[model samples]
Target: MTLQLLNRATALWRAFIVLALLAGTSIEAVTQDNRPLLVAARKKRTQTKKSRATPPKKKEKAPEKAPEKPLEEKAVDLTELDQHGTNTSESYNRLHATQPSSTPNFRTYFDLAFSYRPGDQPVSFENFHSAFLLEYTPMAGLTFMVGLAPPTVLPLYYELDWQITDRLSLRLGRIWIPFDQINPHNTFGGFINTSLLRAASQEAFLPDVWADLGAAAKYDIIRDNDLQVESHVYVVNGFGQGGTDPKGESSSYPDFSLPVARQDNNDDKSIGLRVHGLYRNTVGLGLSFFTGGYNNQGTTNARITMLGADFQAYIAALTFRAGYAYMAVDLPLGTSRQFYTRGGLYTELTLRATDKWKLGILGGVQQNDNNVSDQNDRTIWGGKIEYLINHMMIVSLQYFKDLRQAPGKTNFDVALLRYSLTL
Candidate 1:
């Protein structure tokens, strides 16, 4: 009976195992039939879960607003009057011309100088000055200038300037010839020494070609922050057959004429060249050259050639200046008989003590084979003190000793005091 029971149990277990295997085969077959669909559903569910897990994207920011308009230009006061002689009615005209202005402007400039001399020649107070300078500018590159002074009651200088380019210009009419820095009317100082500058440079072997009917060409060879070079060339009516200007007394080699004659005295016209340079504007140098003809009582073929050099330098409160000139002048006795190289040299030092005061020392010599009629020699030593009363006015006291060694004249001394104003 036990054997029969054990066999029955074994059969029951075998039957159970077979049933489980059949169920497994049926499930596997179903899965194989829907394989593609199951995979797609699983992937779709995974994508939906990922989408729900992430945060939302932010919106884009707006752009900023633009500005309304550009700013307006500043207005100028046209009705304002200037008390300082430096700025006259014409100052505006000059300023306007440098800009783009539609209308022309007119202005006036005034300058005055007075001198007092005491000696056996008698004490005298004389006003030697440049006053009533009128200027007009119609365009950016063009200007017309006219000036009037005493004695002649005529326009001292009248010129038309046309700036052809930034570095070139053309000038016409009576213009100032730049031979020396000392007497160019630049108004560098108040007191002008009659001995040092007048007899040395002003009435030098070369005549003061202050104003002459001519045309000039100017160019800036170099212009920059640290260095600059400028040049000028002029062609004009040269000297005449030097006779007394009806006022009597003519003092020149063959007489470099101060031609008031409207026409040329001879066929030859004079030519002049000047080159100036500046290093940082604290130091300066200039070279001058002139070649021309002179006639004596219509006796043609007389000529004059001149060369000059000048230098200036500034160090702290002190300024130094120097100049030298050599001229080959012809004094026609007959034919091309002879010529002489005569010259002048000068040196000056100035100390600026304060805003209102200045002190200076100057020395010079002029040696000529013939100044008046024979060889002339001169030595000058001078000192000056100046006080600035205002921006437009200055007062100066200067003392000088002029030692002369001439053919037949005794040595003399000259002292002068000057009061000057610029308007």
Candidate 2:
């Protein structure tokens, strides 16, 4: 019985050992089977974490593509609009607004005067001077002008201006050169209030036929509201101010009444240089110098030098002008040195009595050297009354007095009725 009991115990112990071994093997197999799956899951999780960390790079790339499409579309639309002529009106209006207004195509200015002098010719029309100015501007900075006057008394002057820049310009053709205050264009105007005509000194030395055919370049040193300076140079037939005159006239005629003076037939060519300055439009000053020579009959030559200065100022409605000039002539005859000098002062006061009626008082004095003894020093006074019919027309009456007179010689006195029109 003891041996059988021991055998049973041994068998039971062996069975228990075998079962434990089988359980161990199964656990080991299951562990091995799940090992690769666990490793694959962990790798997938790590790759997903790396992809999530790099999200900002994808987000950064997304914005770069959005602006390119809108910019290209806008460029195409602008190009189409430009090609279809939609941009014309604004440019056209801008160009049109910069143009000047059109006035009457045919424009003219004329002055008619009737003068009566004591113990002189009858009260006939002394001068019927008319200037017809035609102007055409093809572009903004270019202008063409043609002027006509009659009777062969004055030359027909023409002008063309091309403004290359705002402050620089070129002017060509025959222009009325400005050297002194009493010039050809301003001397014979019916609107001048002075009663005594231009001074005899100016008539003899500073004649009215002072024009030149040349080109001019103008530059503005100061173009502001306060100051201005302009320089001009000209090359012209320096026929001394009286234009060209025929040679050899008899000396039996009165010297003062002769058409050609002693120094008239001097030279054929000369150069002129002038500078003008203005301050506030109220003050004007000028300096001019001219040098040339004239050849007379035979080898006699007369060299001429002329220097002049002028000033003009307007203080309110009163205008004042003064001028002085020194002229020396070196004749081939002798060393006597013929000298001609003149000084003049003139003033005018304008009284606005009413909207259409105006009154002015004019007075001036002139002193001349080398004039006739009787006419060397003279005083002039005049008065005028004008009616403004409209913007384009004016009518005036004037009276003048000559204060200096000889005991027997008649001092000049005159009355004038004048009418002027402008278009």
Candidate 3:
């Protein structure tokens, strides 16, 4: 019975060991699964605590945009005027430094006049001349200008003008003495108007381009009213009878009274006066007076006085230009006993038939009180028409008749065709 009890106890011990092993294995499996679960739970709790401790990041606001500008409208000014002061430069670059020369600004003109005279004529071609003008503005209110007509390369004038104020300007060097509108190679009327030929009386007593080494001052009234006023005063070396022109040629007979004086024979100089005005933007009037000693030969001394009046007005397509010049010479013919009076008159009218076509009529008379030469008391009348082929080309035809009526006079009935080109 005791042996039986021991075997039974061993069997029971073995069952107990298997049962304990199974319980241990089951516990290990449950611990392995529960270990992963507990670790995952602890990690989730740690993340939750970390999230609670951190603060939220703030958002950045974008910047606002600027407002847009309005579009500008372009325009054209009719009376293109800069009311700025004279000394103030018109260009910004000129004010800073010298003007840079790009393509230079220049003007050149060519004119050819072919004339046909019915009677005996010395030459076939009446006139051949070329004119050129070049101007450069180096800085503000400064100008250097040169004008030339060829056959003689000598410049017509080399003038320098300085603008001191808006209404005042000073000129030095050689300059055209301002007298009548035509004397300076300057035109009195619009394009397609005024005769291409100058009046005989106009050319009788002055150089076509009457320029001399002189000093001049010009003053403008700068008035608000349309009644504009300008005054010119100049002192020059004056002219000598039978002197030479800029072309270095002797003066012709009829042109003896009008000569350019390069050297003065006496200490006395010439004084010129001009008063010009305009009204209603259409009517213009001018008064001119010039006095100078004509000769200083000691035996023959003469004082010349020139009084001139000019008027121009435009009514629609019709334009009228008239001038009267009375020149008086107090000549000591024979030891202060006698003097001669010479005068001249000319008038012109033009009608614009079309925008590019012009028709004109002109009349002129010259009186020589001495009555010694056949050219004394001459009358001239003419008609002219010009068609502007283009802005740069013009074709003009003029017909004129000379009335001398003297016994040995050689009158002329002439026709002229002219081609004028401006570049």
Candidate 4:
């Protein structure tokens, strides 16, 4: 019985050892399978903590800006005005700073002159040649200009100028007739238009600042730094009878009253030619001729002819100018007189006292009709003092005394205070 009990105990011990070994193998297999999953969980936890520690970036704001101001236009250069205070084509183009190009450019300007005449009938204020000018350049060598006076639809002057070549030019429209030095070239020559002898004498025969509807050809015979010579030829509608006859009849006789006739009263047209030369900008000479029929009957040959010559000399601050004009009228069929003739002469001298002061004196004489010695002949003397207020403004005081008919007669006289301005 003791031997059987001992064998049973040994069998129980073997069973216990087999069970312990099986348990150890199962734990090792399970650890190998779950190793990758445990490592991935630890990395995810680290990334979450880093994201929480950092902050987002902020945006920046921009600063405010200031408002801009408007730009102003440039004014004309006043130092370029000639001795006559005139704005010639050369001076105008230079002061305006224009160039010839295919591109278009447009500009506008204003000029005015007004005077207080204390010697008129009941002393009055007068508005002279105030103008609003428009200039246009559409292409190289071409330009168009128009001048207007407000409230009057009529254009004061208008023209198209074409520069065909360096020395040749052509012009059309109602342009200033190239009849004399002052007529075609003078624009805004200070406040004293009456200060020049040419202005006083030419008004009796030719229109002051005479301009007419016409086409002109101008050629520069010689142009250089020290001298310039030019010639002009043109044809235009001549003068007409001053007024319609009282009986509403058209007379075949000539009209001595030469009125500006833009529209032709007759078929005949006027022709004019002028040649001018300037030396060193100090001395100038001009010669002009004009002829046309003034009778209402185009078939008749009643005509008027005029010849003019002018001289200018500038020495230091002093300037001298003189002019002579002669006119002849041819009578129509069956007239008592064969021809009527008239002539006039004038002289002017100007001294520049200072950069801002100028003094001038002028004298002129006119014979209405030399054929018939009547009291219509007249003489004139004038003096002017000009003060330049600035580059764009001028003030002038002038006096004119008329010596008419007889030497001892008390003739009319005028005193004017004028202002000239440009804008």
Candidate 5:
């Protein structure tokens, strides 16, 4: 019984061993089948981990890309940009805000002259004359002036000039009658002509005074080219030939035969007209006509006419001027009538010896129709030397010779010293 029990145990043990072997084989097969799945699962888990890591790397790259861009492309704030733009605008406005100044509108000027002349004769005294002129100009188109001549000769005169347009003007006030080549104030200052002293033929008939107070209307026909035409119509006190009346009244009687005396028939007035023209600022021509009558015991009528021409020319630093005048007069048969015709020719030359010194020569001849009885044709020659201390002061020495004869008189010579000042 022991042997049989042992055998059964051996068998049971073998069977158990076999079953263990089979189980081992099945487990191996199963492991082999699952191997690929395990490897795939591990690969999948690795891919998922790699995807998460790459996402984080991508986020880092996005930040780095921003830094790599150009500095000029950086974003800015609109508010700061607007402030900068406003500041630039304000600066531009300030630079353009200031204004410029305006120009002056009016101007005034004055001229004054004073002269002292010493005569050559024993009976002569130093004569002093002075004039003052003031001018105001509000604009170029309008001007006003007041001039004064102190002492006995010329009275004060006022002038108004209004340029209505560029080409036309209206002038009014007392004006000097324009006739002779030499103005009253400019004719050797206070000296009279030799013809007057010798009583030339023309002097017997011609009027003596150089100026008269009158109103005139002048028109400028041509203005631009230094050529112009002017006409004047006026009425003045009757001609004072030989002497002036005590009351400064003009004569009314036109007596032609009366030599030393002028009778006044104060009932009549005289009218005169003149026309003048200038050419190239060098030449001038004028013509005049006058008519009047003296109402004495019998009414006496008279008529006078004049023609004149003047010339001025410049050669280098020297200037030359000359003029001629002619007059004719008619009087009633019974009334004292003197033939009236007078004229003169004059010339002057100025030489600049130095910057402050000047020398001049002057000569003139005069003829009279009435003074022929006294052989009154006269010739005048003079020379002057001037020294200039400045623009406003001058000293002049002049010598003059008169070639004319009166009754028992011979030619005369005069030396004059003149000092002048201008302000």
Candidate 6:
């Protein structure tokens, strides 16, 4: 009975194993039939778990940048006014300290001077006055200028300038005569006192201020970095013979008070020329010539001729200037006019003692005429000390001694205190 029970139990166990194997095979077949769906479901669950585990990696921000600064302009080399006084607009503005203006393309300047001379004779305000100048530029290469001096009847200068080319210019109206260095810089107290040549010529021979109504042309023959050559040519109404005018002016015989006349006194006109050269701003030279008929009568043929030469040099802190002038006038002798000649020369030296101080000395000699035996000849010795208060203001003390050649004539001495201001 025990053996029969064991065999039945073993058979039943075998049947159970076979049945489990068959069940496993059927489930695997069912999974294979839905393989795509099961695979997708497994992937989705894996991705969800991964997203929850990692917090989406906080986005990394770019590094902060610093603020930028403004760009700086490069340095530039500036050139000064050339020999023709042709300055660029920017340079002109810098040189003049140009002020703001409401009017378009206009500029104005004021110059004032005061002088006190302790002497027998002082200069008349009419002869030397302050100035106010105005300039108008309507277009490129064209300009108009007017300058007025107080206590004077007429304008000091009024002109129109046209720059035809880079090196050529034309000017018309009452203009400063382009003769010597002094006329170009004629403001009282602005420069050292007038040289002997200028004073003698202006008082006895040439027109005051060397000014006249004229048309002028300036040509820059050569201009470069450090060298310049310029030429000026002009035609003007010649000086009038004294006592012949309706204005009640008397004749100064043996001397010429050649005043600049508004109208021509004679049919003939005057002609003048000047040539100048500069080297490295250290050396300068000039030559001038003028010729004109002074006789108001159309029949009388009397004329005047002038020749001039000037030089300037700079060395260390010293500046030197020298000028020479020769003048000849024709005088009526019986029937034919005779030519009498006069000549003069001056030399000046200035020392820049300090930024605000300057010391200067000048010496000059003049011959009135060769016919006279040392009668009217003269010598001048002068010294000056100046203090510059600012770029546009100055004060100076000047002393001058005059030695005359005439017998028994006393040597004259004078001292001056001068002040100048520009606006």
| Tens digit per residue, CA lDDT, model 2, 185-269 | 2221122322234432223333333444666666666778899887766665444322222112212111222122234443445
Give candidate 5 regions above 4 Å deviation: 1-120, 123-125, 136-144, 153-156, 184-211, 225-238, 241-298, 335-340, 352-355, 367-371, 375-377, 408-411
TM for candidate 6 is 0.65
Task: State every prediction's TM-score relative to the real structure.
Answer: 0.66, 0.60, 0.66, 0.67, 0.54, 0.65
The CA lDDT at 155 in model 1 is: 70
Full-model lDDT for every candidate: 0.60, 0.53, 0.60, 0.62, 0.48, 0.61
lDDT tens readout by residue for model 6, 201-263:
223434434557888888999899899998989998767665321112224233243343345
Sort order, TM-score high to low: 4, 3, 1, 6, 2, 5
- Please tell me which model should have the higher TM-score, number 3 or number 5: 3
lDDT (0-100) at residue 33 of candidate 1?
Answer: 97
Off by over 4 Å in 2: 1-106, 138-140, 153-155, 181-205, 240-268, 294-300, 334-345, 352-355, 366-371, 374-378, 406-411
Name the best candidate (by lDDT). Answer: 4
**Per-residue C-alpha lDDT of model 5 across residues 242-329, encoded as one tens digit per residue:** 4222222335323322221243444455566666666776655556555554334344455545565555555556656555556565
RMSD of 1: 14.1
Q: Candidate 4 clashing pairs?
A: none
The TM-score of candidate 4 is 0.67
Q: Candidate 1 vs candidate 6: which has greater lDDT?
A: 6
